[model samples]
Target: MATPAADLANWIPRLLATWRAARRTQRRGGPRPPLDALLPDELREVAAAVTRLSTGLTRERELAGARYLDDERLLGAYLLFYWPISYLQARGVLSELPRLPRTVLDLGSGPGPLAFAALDAGAVAVTACDRAKQALTAARDLARLAGARLTTRDWNPTQGTPLASLTGGTPPDLITLGHVINELWKGEGAEEKRAALLESAARALAPGGSLVVIEPALRDTSRGLLRVRDLLVSRGFAVRAPCLFRGACPALLKESDWCHAERAIDPPPLVAQIGKAAGLRKEAVKMSYLVLAPPGEPWAAPPPGVVLRIVSEPLAGKGRLRYMGCGPDGRKGLALQEKHVGDANRRFETLKRGDVVALEGTEPRGDGLALGAGSRVTVLAEAGRPVPMPVDGQA
Candidate 1:
């Protein structure tokens, strides 16, 4: 449903303007800042801070609960580099919503990447809530620069009022937690707290609304999200997208395996430069996410026949092409022998992770469904493409 940075191409200039205005270092009457501000020196500084911030958030785990975003350099680093990543990530997930959200509430909205992304994706009213005052200020700055209307509030679940306080009397059509829940509680029963918060939000959601939770794709975080998903599922809640299985997640059976999706992206020039200088890859964005429906909303029925989401990248062997797919039947391997790749099933030769595909023909081979001469391949949804719901068809 969402292609990539192209959907947000106009965001490039507005973000540059906001960052440039914040720096306030341009000489009087000097040339305006280019869309891709190739300020090598500034890029180096931002990249160095990006390297530190990235490490602290991903590897070192020291800044999990800290106010690192308050640091001028660190915030700048996030604005130029990580903001685009989160923005694109949100768009990818937003593409899967059953309906476009008219009202959105983004919790832990650091400098408002996801909140603003919601606005760009067509949300009419959005409230960006975060405890970091400095971050909220930046959100305002970005909003002003873009000439876009946004609501900013200070709300930290750890300290502030209950989650219900932020919603006022009217429930939001969409509530988003972008890389926020993992930062809360950090100790025993963290997963429970995360699930509890999401459940509350789901219950409070407007009818036909969605509650989206996006987390880091790190193995531990991904598994933690799966555990939370299981908890919510056990309580009789249903998922809107990404889970064809109605039961506890099958990916968690193996300790080493986790679920995450990679969507193609072409980083803006400065983002690529900063990433290169920081020793990171910026070609694509990756995250583990859940799209949960409000209470009483049932899971969209799966398409007819054998259908599964390609969970793993193509696992090609000497004579076969294989992928792990998770569907209503639970997770299973899908294999097609090289000799069996014909006109009908030749589409299997090019398969990407996150693609929802249907398989027909052939008996079971090793660990999955195999394809043979009679087999026909149909791609119900490509990576990042939205799946059809019952509202659209037979689901």
Candidate 2:
């Protein structure tokens, strides 16, 4: 009972084989020695057309093969590697640089894969850009699957000044060039082209932000992962990779590609509803400790000797919570419960980018100052003076 549609689909492979055979014949004996050996421009149009078709076909298959990826946890593991790699690189840069990145920008973001992943993981927003309109459309569709917002652009990195326009008015916390660097470098004046691309990336980088380049680990060192690593290092990035970072890069791969697509399915309506609410709202405020006021006034107790600044603000509906303290490097530090001597639920949103606040009740740790991610603050400071802090709005 198979319809003509199904019948034609079954015959696709044979048709493709026949077409490829004709193409091979033309390349091998019809004036050209070999398809790849020909001058680059000779195959530009054909290559681009093939690339578009391939991408379109792949998407169609992914949509059709949804059932296959549904039960695949292995695919999730491999997809997770990209984020950790980005985090490690960003952290490595921060160790040597003065500022920390506040945003992540993913370029050549295929299907908005890494961009949306970042948003789910931690980034405030994900800007997914690509040269192909079709690719951007696919990426936007993918973003819809997650109920997340994405800003997409049509851009080809190889030609035109579109990169400059795309990045205008805003600098990115991190610039990611995944799999596209090699293709961009294939034309004439490859070095100049690469430098031009890097210069653009460098210009768009926020203070202390990193430019991430990841390519296939192919034999062509000049056009593969090795080249990307070297190029980034030469641009003054503190390079850290599986090859460089000792045991830092874990194998995110599994037996099959299933690991990467496990999360592709839409969650149940109830679960999705709850998740959407969670995604829409600000996270719960975590109070380090409750500072008790003596009788009439809450300010009776003298402020602690050393007060930390408030790196984050409180939630809109909650006023009893407040986060205070800056890391030794001026980066925000989370106010932990173990360090607070007062009531629980006093710690507000983990300290964010700005806000000069302090804590009271506990003593400062070591040299009366804490450094690094998990620092302790005995007292939380306030902005200018300890006026009543405003409640945060529902995010």
Candidate 3:
């Protein structure tokens, strides 16, 4: 069977072709703009429009009332450019779970790209909720084209209702808030609204169920997620990834930095065209995310000596590689000298964010780990690998 990524790679082009044909037919005698002909100025205008929609502390009613959500040109641009990025983000997060969710509830599910990703990742059913009827309609159309199982519901998350109530009494195994938290942050009493939403979502988790929240990698958004992480831990939820212990985030201690992860994605052709036209480089997807389960159902503990999860990009120095990471004990910095790791030095150099590594002869330093010349380094799993659901510490 094709993986979710493979299925999407196959489905997007066909959808784009159909949309292009519809445009041609509608234009009649007039020449239609090529599907990928987003000019540099137009790209910047779109980017500015998106930022306007996103940056405020409250939803920009004027912008929302604009055809931003319903305009065919804008929607097509988003489907061709932004949808792939969101799809990759969803795929990366879902792929890390111990098992595929049988049912998913995607909140603020604009155009339902994430819902499609969940269905492709083996979800039997998906409930996508959004306030924008236009977005939900587009999502429904896309689902039909893709032949996926998805149901749409009208919801405004800012109202702070228990998400399970919207699911008709059948709680989902996975609940996702993708790129929604920041939007919630735009209103008055933002923190309270977020708290209410999270509290309600936590209450909705079934046995072994998980909640995954993803946001943009902006400094404020990343810090906000860290605060949310602390909140979840205080509420007795077990954080499954990115964090190894229930402590204050170490990355936040430095006033100049924030914690986030990066995942590379191969862009579709249309995305490449948009990138070229916009003078934007299509690189790795960067975001801050949290995965949590009910308290008693914590993720499997790491193997002996494999304590730290490298949560940031590795820093390369003269002869050593420095990793900032979180461990079972707390957040710590780990250093590996080129001579000490020997052959594994190459692998160490290539390690991406979110890798689980085992280090030998390491002792805690101020707020990190110190390695000696004889210390050994081993990678248990690279970033984005589907961690096995271990039973009693055994997989």
Candidate 4:
């Protein structure tokens, strides 16, 4: 199977060719502006609209009817700008899984970006569901052009249909909800609707299967996903990534903070232009995501005795590097200072949030954990690992 990056490299050029051809045909016999020339201003407008939708400042229904969705130029700008971000996000989530899924069901799959990602990740068959016919049509066209094994369905989860029923009797090995929960939050009975949708997705998961949900890293959306995390735990699903414990979320306990992850992505040329025009930062993509498997199902687990999973970016101070993380016990902080560890500081400095590390000789500090100079700090997993660490310090 091809890696997501390879698959994206092949798919993007074809989509661009199609988009350009469509543009030329739309303006046949007229002086048509260069796609690059028209992209910056159009991308700025789409970026602002996307921000509004993600922040709940504007409703999806209104945005759907607005020119952003209705106008072809704006829609094209959005697809081009968002394609790499979505692909990178999907690659990040799929990399944590123990193995490639045989089948995938992508819910609320706008333009089927994630479905394509799953296909690239070795899912033999992918089913994409969305409410918008136009989005489905675009997905179908892209899938056809790419010769990918994709099927499309027009269904709205808000209508109370069981997701499993839509997939026939064959349960999917992986289910993805990408940026869909935030839109669901806007309707009446949002809580009930979200719970029902999740429950259905869980029920539809095959044994040893996983359900992954991704949302914007905004305060509200991230907090909302935290709530979803707690709800899934309560329903007996085991979290598989970005969390070291199944206990209560530490970030949610705080009023002003939320748990989210960030990864750097190299934007495509047009996306870079749009970022410059809109003053948007294109270096890092931040999001809140959860991966859950049914209880008793086998998936990747952290190395033994590696209790704390760094959940925040490493904070570098004058002489020490501080890590805020979660453990099976609860939320804890750890500090690795240069003066104490000497040359070992270089190794510890390489550690980032989401890496699992064991503090060999540490004791509890105020709301955090402390490591002494004599302590052996070993990285158990750079991200999430399925294998155990060596007992000796040599690893």
- Candidate number of the best lDDT: 1
Question: TM-score of every model?
Answer: 0.94, 0.37, 0.86, 0.86
* Clash statistics: count for each candidate: 1, 27, 4, 0
Runs with alpha carbons beyond 4 Å of true place in candidate 4? 1-3, 18-25, 29-74, 187-189, 295-302, 384-395
- Residues 1-395, candidate 1, lDDT per residue (tens digit)? 34456646666676666666777455466555467664666777788899999999999789887899888778888888888899989988988887889899999999988998899889989999999887888899888878889998889777745777888778999999999888988878888988888998898899999999999999988899999999999998999878999999999999999999998777877788888889999787889999999988778888888888999888989898888989888988888889877898988888888889888775776666777878998999998778764642344
Task: RMSD for all candidates, in order, please.
Answer: 2.2, 19.7, 3.9, 4.3
A best-first ranking of the candidates according to their lDDT comes to 1, 3, 4, 2
Worst 10 residues of 2 by lDDT: 256-265
Highest TM-score, which number?
1
Residues 284-379, candidate 4, lDDT per residue (tens digit)?
Answer: 777888888755553344456646777888788898888887877778888877777855334567777677777677777797877767667777
Q: Which regions of candidate 2 fall more than 4 Å away from where they truly are?
A: 1-102, 221-225, 228-395
Q: Model 2 over residues 1-395: C-alpha lDDT tens digits? A: 33222322322232223223334224444553331122333234334433333243234422211221122221221122122222222222222222333466677665454464455445576677766554465456545544567788766665565555766567777666654555564435665666567656766666545565544333242233333334444454433211211111111122211100000122222222222332321121111111111112111222234333443343332222333233323322233433332333233334332233344344345433323223333333222123222212311
Candidate 2's C-alpha lDDT? Answer: 0.38
Which sections of candidate 1 miss by over 4 Å?
A: 1-4, 24-33, 391-395
Q: Encode model 3's per-residue lDDT on 193-230: one tens digit a residue.
A: 67568767866877777788888787877887787777
Q: lDDT value for candidate 4?
A: 0.71
